[model samples]
Target: MPAPSSTASAFLPVVPRLRSLRNSITLAANPIPVLDTYLNTYGDTIVVYLGGIRRTVLTRDPGLVQHMLQKNHRNYPKSDLSHGVARYLGHGLLTSEGSYWLRQRRLIQPGFHRQRIAGLVALMQTEINDCLEPLERQLAKQGGFVEVAVHALMITTAFRIIARSVFSNSLAERQLHRMAELLTAIQAFYVRTVRQPYLRPWQHARGQFRRHDQLAAELRDIVRGYIRQRKEASGPVPDDLLQMLLDARYEDNGEPMTEEQVLDEAAILLVAGHETSANALSWMWYLLAQHPEVVTKLRTEITQVLGDRPATFADLPGLGYSLQVIQETMRLYPPAWILDRVAQEDDTYNGLALPKGTLISGYLYGIHHSAKLWDEPEAFRPERFGPDQVRQQVPYAYIPFGGGPRLCIGNQFALTEMQLVLLEMLRRFDVEWVEQPAIDLMPLITLRPRQEIKVRFRRHKA
Candidate 1:
């Protein structure tokens, strides 16, 4: 993909099974600190037993990560750790592989092009303003400042943006809430099963798997109903993601995707599109509240670009600082903090041997926060993304959206959404830090704050 950042050492370290077993509970509770401890004790790349059962090679080495994700991606497909979600989310882009994934990728990639995303700007802004109205009312009633649980607020805003972008007005408010609830429940349970494999037998005895499967079915049914409604409508199809999927034709054969295929991809789009942005936005507020200087700088940029107006897609490019803030937030707290891939066949990187079927956990969080890679890994600084500064950084060392051929399809959409949210919120309100205990990381299917993060929003005064 890019030049190897550094040479990977041939010597590999392994954490003993007994130690891993002993630390299983601690790892399940919060793996970031524990994993960091291991990497510190051992080296960048080490073999460890996940839950003390599954043998896995976990590494934060950027060179190896690029090798697996780009240089030889075909030789590394998503392992069962990732595909496990397919059992609940269906064989969408996030879960599917081989010719099917490639075909679907080619078919759907155009839908997220820069121009297509620009088309959805108005749709995104509409939803964002709607989401902000209630908070605005709250501020008016409370005399200018309102304390909010930023994570919950971000979740609602993000879901509405993605849901409306995809389905338009096809889904009612009640159904929208229900779909969000079901997806959350299924993902929570899925992460539990993966983290605590020892509890699976008991989980099975308790019908947890069956229950989540039912939730999955219910989620699909809700989307299916709306899809069928659109198919039966006589009028012209609305300009939304669902219609885009319906209208896409495969190149080899001019056939459109099947109903099931549409459902799977749409479901995938909903999940992938919303979750990452929501988490990143939540963490962005967390950082901004504490770093008011950064917020002040943001307000300056916002004022220079669009004084007395909300941002449109055309206005985003001028708001480079907003984008840098988002890029920095993701660097510190990446939503898809870690990614999994398995060696399709025997392979070598630098000098380490990876046999067929060997599981490799690309510790993206570790890579992002490594002191060797970043000047101040823990500090929040958006200036690192300035044009000149960015060019000098090592490649793959800052992959919040990942690297290589199979990079996140919604990367542009996500960046645009986050930038819009930051600019809009700061344009209207002054984000102030509220007194609370320090936030802890909750590494679920996505990285989340363990405790609620509260921030105060004061209406801006010129």
Candidate 2:
């Protein structure tokens, strides 16, 4: 058998100062620059200390990532950070570990099947139109000079799509607004907790825990009400994700999940299903705005296929270039920028020994922009993902949604949502950048654009 790779301590020089609380806060708050410097200066593999904890950072080496995420996955479990994350997200698929995760995965996977997703195409198109129509009318009246943050619109778009897919017009406007507010609050608190370990004592003492509890309770009540209503209603069953979950049977005993399990999974789906996709779309529009040539080319392609028609799932195959744009955008600014795993047993990689409980940080943003893996790593180049090209690339080099058994189950859902939204936006409006916005890294639960991307939209002429 092959010997284990060397531990990080043996192969990479460690940044000792990062262990200090002050230094850790700085690094956590400003991760991209630090990460870029490390990957560029220290090579693909390096170890850093965060708050006295030794963490290994692996960048750009697809072989190493594949090994960690797939080949030896059992030896590396979800990290403690994930547990903290689950505290708010509940024991859903995103947060569940061990057999609980396995069980949840088995029960929930069927709902996201391609056939089921295809059936929701019409609904997605309607949501896209609903979001675009107002923007289009505004652009026409304002002569294409509107100061709109694309990210904000993308957030609402994602929520509408996911909400309709689950409850299908059942959610009242007030309830939807409350759901958004609660989710935003939870995300803000989560960012605080992750970045400020020192604040933990005071945060808990100040009833922050109770606030989280209240938020979770509110979300659970909303989800449970929907599930209960579906159960009580005696009519033709709908073909939505919620209904799919309602019908799914456990493999072990052919039993359905309890109400709590269903609620947890539903809430997770709502949050995860929307946040990452919205971030991606927001960044893509920003990139396209800066590169007008690329935008022009995309418009050409979109206009040809859409040609005075709204884009449907049927047009997806023909929107290959548009899809490539989204892919490249994700590569440059992956929403799930960092993935963490903890060593379950001693292991070695590249002559570095890793003890049990060692945390491994897969710096995906660093990897995606690594010079060794990508040429002109900082530039926007959608053709990199052309039909004849991507297969030749290394497997884990482009893990926007991640890899292995724990790969994002909603990968297809996010992709479909992006494609539909991008195509529809391009079909109805012309987006132009107001200015070259500063790109700052907000490394929380997901990486977000620190500065809102402002753009002016012009209505497309038939």
- How many clashes in each structure? 0, 11
Compose the digit string of candidate 2's lDDT tens values, residues 1-462. Answer: 112235545656555443334466566677677666656666677666554344555455777777789999988777877777677778888888888888889888888888888888888888888887777677668774666878889989988898888877777878887887788788889867766666789999999989987997887788899999999999788878888888889998999988888888888888888779889998998888788899888878977887867777767878899889999999999999888888898887766677787778888988898777788999999999997889877788899989999999988888898998887777777778786648676777787888888877777665
Minimal lDDT window, size 10, model 2: 1-10
TM-score of 1: 0.97
- Candidates' TM-scores? 0.97, 0.94
**Model 2 Cα displacement at 398 (Å)?**
0.4
- lDDT per residue as tens, model 1, 200-296: 9999999999999999999999999999999999977778899999999999999999999999999998988877899999999999999989988
Worst 10 residues of 1 by lDDT: 1-10
Tell how far residue 431 is off in model 1, in angstroms.
Answer: 0.7
Clashing pairs in 1: none
Error of 2 at 107 (Å): 2.2
